[model samples]
Target chain A: MSRRARAGVESRIDAPAGDGAPGGSGPGWPPWACRLAGVAIVVHLSALLAGVMGVAPASPLERAAMEWFGPYHAFFDLGYSYRFYIEPPPTPVAVATLHFDDGRPDETVRLPAREIRGPRMRHQRELALAHSLFVDARQAKEQTGDISQSRLARSYADRICQIRPGCEMVVWRVVQHLIPDRDQVRDALDSPGAGRFDLFDDSLFATPEWIGDFPCHGR
Target chain B: MPRPLIEIRRYLAELSVSTRAGWNRFFFAPADPTALGLIRAAVGLLAFWSLLVMGLDLDAYLGSGGWESAELAWSSLRPFAWSFWFLVGDAWLRPAWIGCLVVLLFFTLGIFSRTTSVLSWMIVVSTVRRAPAALFGFDQIVSMLLLYLAATGASGQAFALDRYWRRWREAKRTIRAIPARYRKDGLGRAVEPDTPGLPAATVSANLALRLIQIHLVMIYAIAGLAKLQGVSWWNGEAVWRMMATGEFVMFDFTPLARWPMALSALTHGSLALELVYPALIWPRLTRPIMLTGVACLHVGIAVVNPGLSEFALVMIAANLAFVPGLYVRRLAIAHEQPAVRVLFDGACPRCRGWMALLTAADPCHVLAAVDLTAVDVRTVHPALTEAGCLKAMHAVTASGRVTAGFDALRAILLRLPLFWPVALLGYFPGVAWAGRIGYNRYAASRPRDVPCTDSVCGIHSRTSPPAARDRSRSHAPNNATAIQEDS
Candidate 1:
């Protein structure tokens, strides 16, 4: 055989670290490259596929990575990049009201969703938590006919106190008909009078300590 | 009547082989070292800059009493228990930050390329995790780039001080190995020449570049698909919404109300380019165009949108992989080293075609071609006469060595590291005989239109007069072409 052909056979036999089988990456290509690339392609594609197949394997990992890394998860995981925004039809808007009993200015602290801070993912986490708390409060009102004694109401009221010092009363409420008319201009979407208060179920949370002789405490 | 089933089976086998060959080429082709070197330096600098930026408010960011207190940082982590900050106390924060910076500096310099690359990537992840609230586009991309960079070896190919240090080591070793030879500097003491080693291209670098390329595709594909689901992207209100948002508004785009179409196109065009990127970037012909378009897209985003912040810059930096290593090598090395201008018969389509690929594939664009078909080859080359042009393919090196035929091919291949092995094989007697026979065959198989094409011109065929025209010598030049494929 020609020397060139002989060297080819030798290179194949040796199969050095950078040199794979014949016709592997070019003669100069790293030997470990093809397999590494293959593994990566297979793993990344499988993650993407599982993400598509309703996340049998990837979903758990995706959720874990998200909780761990938040916005940084996209660096480690592969699913959330293509996730679309499908929020439940806006329920008036979930708002948290903080009522101070030590009597300061009448302050209504809107749910954390409205006040976005830092990265979008952080804001997203805040919204998701607020929505969960809002849902739990509604379920409690449906069950007990009152939100003041609800566990979520008390815990959430405590958090509000932590977030804002010396706060006494906190109430969570939803204004019905939050999505504006199709024909309405963009500027009108956030207008104060755009939606009506669901007075009967609007009060989602309040401080449990001061049920007061105050008439508005339960309402 | 042909055997249809048997023929179909044969065709499928051929197709399978062809595809396998292509797959091998894609995954294993000896990657250009210059390209990897370029990517390494670029990625390293970005890492250095990023890591340095991370330390700007390190004490405040990771300190016990700053914006993110230790308690808040730990609680924010929840069940995911991983962080550099959690392990290190407040007193060690500055020291840790400094250590991270030193490692990043070494990484960027390619001192201990892969080791420092991994260390830097770890630091990036640790720092990012410590302050999730502070994370943005730049932080995410830097981490991703570092992860990919860690997978490859010898990212510091060209323009790295590591090359100088490596050569100094190699030179010292050579001086020691050669006890009899007196090597010295101007002081006349034994020493190695300061010339650095040729950009040491490696397979690892190729694989790394490919990985980055693949990862970029996935990012674009996912991002494009996600945008497709958004109502604003479809309604053309996406740009308007972006403009209206206080968080994203960089340049004053309020005038977009009057030129709504321009605003809509800007938003929609970005999505359109991203959707097409993964699909079109695979084909070689479209690869450059797609890479260029995406690069511009990022530049536009950086200029007009700027919301992704470091995301745009990091992506543009990553896209450097597609810039073609041969071209980069040509830019970096062609000036520092000797180059040869080639003289070829441009009338030969096969020759011109190979020349085009060689030119395109050449990492160092040092090969200047002067077509003998149109002009007097001597006028441009100065050394070569018309007889030399007819003798074989020739090139005049910068030192003005007029090389011809297989030797000429060897000289060109010598300059390209990928083709150096092919050139070395030509030195073997058996290979040399086969190659000469092959070159003569192609040279003899003229299209039969040239003036005085026979007689002395076809001296190799003079042994077996004209009727058969050296049928046995036919595949020789093909081997020669194969030899130069690395170039």
Candidate 2:
């Protein structure tokens, strides 16, 4: 194409020549279209604000706004609460012990197994799965029932039974790994270089809370 | 009209006009799609990697017999959320997974970008929806980015095969019409030719980038505000707490316990940076500081929390939203081929015209052209003689290897987006031999340069063709003398 024609095309696409918020005039959509788009943008921004605000520990007003904008968030799959490290809780992990139907030794499996060799992203997925088991436990506690009876746990146990064909039964529990305070770490370690206190010390863990036990059958 | 009533009417009119103009500038003002294209390419690759990893445990994660049964996972999505995996049987699982991977690969490569980007997003959403139990912050950020990229529909305008294909087609047509143009006008009227700068800009590109920027600000604001509710964040123990968490920790952070003050600083600094980012990021002055702070915070998290490394990478990628398109375009170009220097005979108008075409074709800015006539050719490389450079083009590659003649042209074409197809063809068996012979003949056929002592030579020198003038001007002062000489 000729340079002038190309330059004309480019100039047509140039941003408005001005500063922020008050005025910036350029060739653009007609007034009505701009107004229509402005309204849509306002609504979408409001929905985004409400979606974040509606995360738990929210006030009644935020909750109501979220409810109003629920469909928008749901459709876009934008249910991000953005609550990174908020009220950080003790780490919860599921430990599964498999007993084989054959004359094989029992094997222990962690849902987010440290031995789950691969990319950290894959490990992160396993961690999320482990978290679901913990979520199941938390929900069970809220409802004052056995975690084994929860649908998540049942489905999880069933899947475990189906996959490890040799396994006759599967038993799993949720354990919370508590973070020791500064004082506790200082007291436990003999010196800065001492091996006395490791971050993974077994003493920092809560007792394992049983989630479920299931016998493997060809479902 | 009364004075007060007239004043009120004027005020209202001004407000209305300003508001309309501001709205158009913010959302509808056109921007180069380079930044959005960068994001699309990155997010597409991330999505591809993410889906590929899921394939490792496809049966265990998305299969009907997987960790969470399809029935249960599908049922939980309820009325609003949907996934193609919900309907796929065990038999179709691998095929569906492979298809999504193929689409994502194309999206990453910018092949049929507009359609593939949407498909890539759909595939991402479907996969995430189906395997919700496997989600983390990575999923959230990836989804958000994909939404904006797909919405823009112009993400393929820069650094994409879609763009390359379009330009390639234009070049093909232009080449085909050249003979006809020559037939029409002896040498054809030498009008100004197109040279590369930024890609075409559009309102959709602006809107997409704006949406991503706003969304990222909201994320930071929300995350920061949410952290304020916790005692750990207030006391500067949150970072330590996260470090000590078993599932996420890559290395034991117990030694960090001794450096509580440093921990506190990190904790407080992260919180403060997040809190201020939404406000500070809009200003040009504070944007770099905020982006640096963000990189540090996320990279720190990634180092300590390996499981959340993907999340950290996603957050860093999202922050690119705040970066200007010009910088992103330059960065993308610089990354493609940073160390190739082309030595050309600047005195030759034909050579200068060829250089003009090359510079226009090279969106990546891969070649750094050094004029053979302007400098001591030996200074560029001990091996480079002025006579050798004048005879054929020479290119010094990143590895310090020198290529000449057809090989040099082929090397240059490999880096230019439009010439990749032709360049690839030169690599086929005996094609290089034929190409080298053809290049030698063409070089030999060019008229030799001679000093202007007659009206014919003077006219030819003065004409200097439009492309030669433009190309020579982009070089050193000596090139002006080169432009005055006849060929």
Candidate 3:
């Protein structure tokens, strides 16, 4: 390890190697773009995770961020799954009975369950999401205050209007729960003016007026 | 700057260089074409099928007066920055939708590949924004796959017309280049580019594959983490409930519903798979087994759930990244003559440059190399000589013939199966004579740094065990002592 040998090595490198291609790390100073992309992707992943966690009592900033980026959550949350009545056997869940201006008063009207369960291509996916929003809000309402459920119900009304075309106004949004209890379900269906054998709407839990188009959709 | 601050600055600079090197190794390295090409064809067709399924209810879902009207969709998605429906009116919507359908067909067929790929992705984004309710995990997965595919231009490298078109042109050009002697024999005209498994590796393809791999891991991790929070997942009753559900119920599973133990086992098993998938899919040894397990799980979902076939297929397509192209190539070309090993002085700057150039040029990768200057050279080849190795390039053939200097390099080039026409051109009467003189003169022109010490050798610090050294130093062209079959 003499000075002479080290100098020789340096001199050899200094001499033109005649290699045509550029030195290693081709493309000078492009790491900025990569760093930017890297940061953006990380932020996106974090926002999606936050959405899936559905953080309650979130800070004002967190809520605002979620509201803005929440729609993008669908792509990231593909792994987030929610299947209906998966355990303890299938149970009947209540649906919002759609009563239109054309329908008679005091007559039973319900969400189209048949269309929701129809053949593959013919099956309208809109009913599924509408029903999901309805059930989710109602379930949340059981633990939280009435405010959360009311907001969700309003959103559902708008969504349903968008799905059911020419449905200018809704007569009522009151719906009764369908319990799994055989005796209770039978009583509700067999009652004088019952809606369906499995599920029927009651006037006990009447949500507020949902007469016009959603604010976003503009009547 | 103060002394301490200057030292800290130097340390930070070194760290930056190291980090950049690591990033390049992980993300910017070239990827083999086999897996990239396979993924493109399989995933592209699956995406096309998904588009078709969405098309069946296109008007009902995305039309102006349909269930999910354009106006309503736009309003609902106003928070988002962009939507294709915002650009086109009802009159233009049908044509746009039809254009997407046509573009997707071209994407699957790999026509105007890069252009069609971008168009296909645009269509996917439009569909997602317009009919958000109609989408499932399947749609999301196809879009994600297409996103990665669009980033890579070589997606159509295999099972594609693009490959054949390029091959035909290359063949025609190569035949024209051959000297009249070989041309008259018709050997040059009969030749074709053997690009099947030997896809030229590309940085873009490699980066896209790495992204897909990381994304897949994240998805599984999140899925498993999410399931762990659910109450039904704890008792395995959730599995039964999915089968017994209303709209999702494709088959009667009342019998499984009766067996609490079986259902619980399945539910827990599902959770376990999702959690462990990310961990097991990294190592080369376990990657295959992990992907097979994934395939089975997806297939089970597809079979039990009638409408989820597309989802299952696309997921399996994503797993294609884990399949090793090199392993597949070796398996496909088994029993061929083992590649000869070349030994060179990696410490020499010129030699290092030669290694880099030769590494890229050898498409079929016929020659293997080792650094003669490495300390472990003695361990790898007990009989390898220091002086002879430093003197010139040396390649030991599989049949154990020692070819020296320029011929050592030529031996490697000559071994390429597909580009033998080009090789023959180099080996021709006049070209061979000129090439030898040029290579010998280049070798002789180097300064004789005879008192070569440990400090002079660049690879002096790099001491590796035989197996590890062989794998890493296989890129280093070797010297006179040892020649083993390329691993």
lDDT of each: 0.56, 0.74, 0.56
Cα DockQ of the candidate 3 complex: 0.06
lDDT of 1 by residue, B1-487 (tens): 4799889999999889766665655556565555556666666676666656556656545665443456655665534345677788878988988888888888777778768888877887777667654555566667767877775654765545566466555545543333244222111112333342344445566666776776677778766776776777887666565544332334654444556577668778878888899877765567678878888877765555454545666788787766655465544455644387777654343454445434433433457666554455667667777556755678788887887777788777776554657889998879877887787577655331122343433433323234332431332233223222422
- lDDT tens string, model 2, A148-174? 776677778788787678889888888
What stretches of model 1 exceed 4 Å from their correct place?
A: A1-37, A48-219, B1-16, B63-81, B171-197, B305-307, B330-487
List pairs with backbone clashes in candidate 2: none
Taking all chains together, the TM-score of candidate 1 against the true structure is 0.54
Tell me the TM-score of each prediction against the true structure. Answer: 0.54, 0.78, 0.57
In the range B1-487, model 2's lDDT, one tens digit per residue, is 9999999999999889766656676688766676677788788888999899889889988899788888888778745777878889999999999999999999988899889988988888887888787778888899988988887687786778776555545544443343233222111112112323347566667778888888998999988998898998989898888877766787877777788898889889999999999888876667789999999999999998877777787888878767767676444454645457788754455665566566655655577767665666687788887667766889888778899999999998887755778889989999999999998777655542333344423333233445655543443244334434522
RMSDs, each prediction? 19.4, 9.4, 18.9
TM-score of 3: 0.57
TM-score leader: 2
Once fitted onto the true fold, the runs of candidate 2 whose alpha carbons sit more than 4 angstroms away are A1-27, A30-32, A101-105, B1-17, B179-197, B332-361, B364-393, B396-487
